[model samples]
Target: MLHSSHEPTDYQCPFCELLNDQPFSPDNLCAPSDLIYRTPLVAAIMACDGFGNYGGHVMIIPTAHLEALYDLDEQTGSAIMWETKRVALAMKLAWNPAGTSTRQHNEPAGNQHVWHYHQHVFPRYADDELYRQLRHRVSVEDRARKALELRSALFSAEHPYRLTDTDVVR
Candidate 1:
């Protein structure tokens, strides 16, 4: 269970502090429900509304949180990029959109709320106005259900390896 947020901590960053304070839970360690892909070093999961505007809002985050891209070691950086490509491919396959955009925001000025460095994958479609409007109106329960549905679709036997990384550039 997540710890009480009322307790004050000396840690400077909220994300770092949460990581330090909470007892590690395997479920928490697992990707969020909207997760569509995973690799040994990185995982792609959907972001909550606080993170973005899209319904299929995905984020590729290193299994180990690194505060900033500059803070990432060379190996981790490469791994993140590899995982990102896999995610983009999965998004394209699932949404079949006209295009896709990948983005990363760091620090306060960059509008990063999680503190951990993560890349965003937004799927775009030619006629997606309905999706845009629905994304905004979705309730938390509806989002949770959709996330579960996405997870099942991505991980089913037919697509067992769809999200698995391939020949990541070392």
Candidate 2:
């Protein structure tokens, strides 16, 4: 039987395996209150509204806990892509950004923390003031509030995608 909590031994990547073994820490993990929707492949959560002055920031993360893109199997990568599309579609429908920016970074030098592979989806407005200051100005409390708001929005039955437990396939 496949053990849900144990790291896969044949992955070939140690960092990826290490991520699987790491204990779940709330500080390292984004707040659950910020969670919008979840699936076996990924979870969508609000990234905090005041972050870049326009709000509507979302992150899509693979549930498998791979540390970086290189650690994921082809199947997992494909699933993450599909989930990302779903998130982008939901963001566009709900927040209506003038444009959207998707970003991914790896390692400390790359400004990545938490050691998990994730993609950032930002809803951008044309004249947002905080655009240039995003790297330095996002606040945790604001992010938490945004996350809660997003969670409330996504949980509504009228939301486009009805995410369920079965959506998360191993």
Candidate 3:
């Protein structure tokens, strides 16, 4: 659940706080993670409220804080989707779910809760309750572990998103 609002909020935007942090850390859930897989334009992090009933779930967000798809440029959008496809395949490799899906939200009216333009990628099995299950927040350690596994998969697995020869975290 992510949200976008041009209006004001009671407090502050968590994602903004994340983007502003100098040198993000993997252990800090509110900040960016070194464990996250990154392209030049986007970063994919384990969703803080990740799967309770599943594994290998993640959210891809632009490094920049754009409110919605409407605010994104073509290059950044392409990078996000490309990394998304890579992450989806990595999820398949790591978790082996029956299928996968991509989700995004806009305003509070549309079930958008976070408001920083993120895309949710999840693993789905038949008869699974990902949509119906509302209480799936994995422990922080589990999230970090799953993130490591997925990041390793992305680093090693040959994918279309690899445009140039590059090194990645192992």
TM-score of each: 0.62, 0.65, 0.79
Task: Please provide, for model 2 over 98-159, each residue's C-alpha lDDT reduced to its tens digit, 9 standing for 90 to 100.
Answer: 77777787766766654567788877777765446554334667666666655544544666
Number of the candidate with higher TM-score, 1 or 2: 2
Best first by lDDT, ranked: 3, 2, 1
Q: What is the lDDT of residue 146 in candidate 1?
A: 52
Q: Residue 121's C-alpha lDDT in candidate 2?
A: 80
> Can you write out model 3's per-residue Cα lDDT over 1-170, one digit (the tens) per residue?
34335545553556556655654334344534523665557777887775445644788888787877777899988978988888888877777789899998877666777657889888788866778756565666777788887876676546444423363322
Q: What residue pairs clash in candidate 3, if any at all?
A: 2-113, 3-114, 3-115, 4-115
**Which candidate wins on lDDT?**
3
Cα distance off (Å), candidate 1, residue 57? 1.1
The models' CA-based lDDT, in order, is: 0.55, 0.59, 0.69
Task: At residue 113, give the lDDT of candidate 2.
Answer: 57
> Which parts of model 3 have CA positions greater than 4 angstroms off?
1-4, 7-11, 19-35, 158-170
Model 2: lDDT of residue 129: 55
Better TM-score candidate (2, 3): 3
Writing each residue's lDDT as its tens digit, candidate 1 over 50-131 gives 2234455667777675766766788888988876665565555565667877778666676665557788776776555533
Which of 1 and 2 is the better model by lDDT?
A: 2
Kindly report which residue stretches of model 1 are placed more than 4 angstroms away from their true locations once superposed. Answer: 1-32, 35-37, 50-54, 127-161, 164-170
Residue 32 CA error for candidate 2 (Å)?
Answer: 2.0
